[model samples]
Target: MSHVSRSAAVPPDDLSGPLTLDDLENRADKAYARHMETYTAVTVLHRVHMDHAVWNDTASDTLGLAREMVTAYRDVTRKEWYEAYIAWATAAGFEIPADMVNDGTDIPTGAADDPPDHPVY
Candidate 1:
C-alpha cells in the first residue's frame, strides 16, 4: 500500500485566533487534494485485488461473485465513486465488463444473478 499524507485537513497556522479567508481556501484545497489522492489509491487497490489476488485463475461464476461485490459497493456510494473507478479502469484498459454494472431495481435482497452450474476453475 502507498503512504498518503496523514496531515489534518486544516490550513497552516498564523499568529491569529481563527483562520482567515485565504487560510480557509488553502484548507479547502488541501482537503480536496487529499480526497482525490485517497480516491485514486482506493481505485488502484480495487483493480489490483480484482485482477491479481481475487480473480487469479478463477472461474467465471466466481468472477460474477466479485462483480456482485463491486456493484453492491457501487450502490452504497451512490455510483459516484464507482463511476470514477470505471473511468480509471477504462483508462487502464481494464474494461469493467457489462456484467458488473447492475440494473437499479427494487428486487428482494439475496436474489441476483445465479452462479453457473459446474463452474470451472
Candidate 2:
C-alpha cells in the first residue's frame, strides 16, 4: 500500500559487503509487496474494465487483446510475489518449502497458504 517498486527492496549502500539474512528478508518483502499491488490492480481491471467492455460489446478485438495482456501480467505478478514470499519465509526460518503439485511444479496459485489451483477470478 505504501511506496513499492518492481525490484527488490533497497539494500545497504555499501555493495562490497554481503547482505545479512534480515536484509534478504527485507528485500523479498518489498518485492512481494510490489508484485502484490500490481496483481491486485490487474485483477480489478479485469473484473471491472474488461467485464464492462465485454458486456457492452465495445471493440471486441481490442478488449480481447487487453484481456490476454492482463492475464499474462497477472500470472507474472503472481509468480514473482510468490517467489519473494518464499525467499522471505526462508530467510526468516531455516527453509520454507514450496507447495508443489503432483506434476512436480509449484501449486501455480499463490503463496504458501493458498489453496491448490485456486481460481484467479
Which regions of candidate 1 deviate over 4 angstroms?
Answer: 1-16, 53-121
Candidate 2: which pairs clash? none
User: Which runs in model 2 stand beyond 4 Å of their true positions?
Assistant: 1-17, 43-58, 94-104, 107-121
How many clashes in each structure?
Answer: 0, 0
Identify the leading candidate in terms of lDDT.
Answer: 2
lDDT of 1 by residue, 1-121 (tens): 2132233232324545544344444444554354344434445445555566445456645655665665555444434444444433433345465655546653212222222222233
Q: Best candidate, TM-score-wise? A: 2
Writing each residue's lDDT as its tens digit, candidate 2 over 1-121 gives 2233324344443575655556666767776676555545545555665466336456566556766675676567666666656555544444444342224464355254333222365
Return the lDDT, model 1, position 24: 49
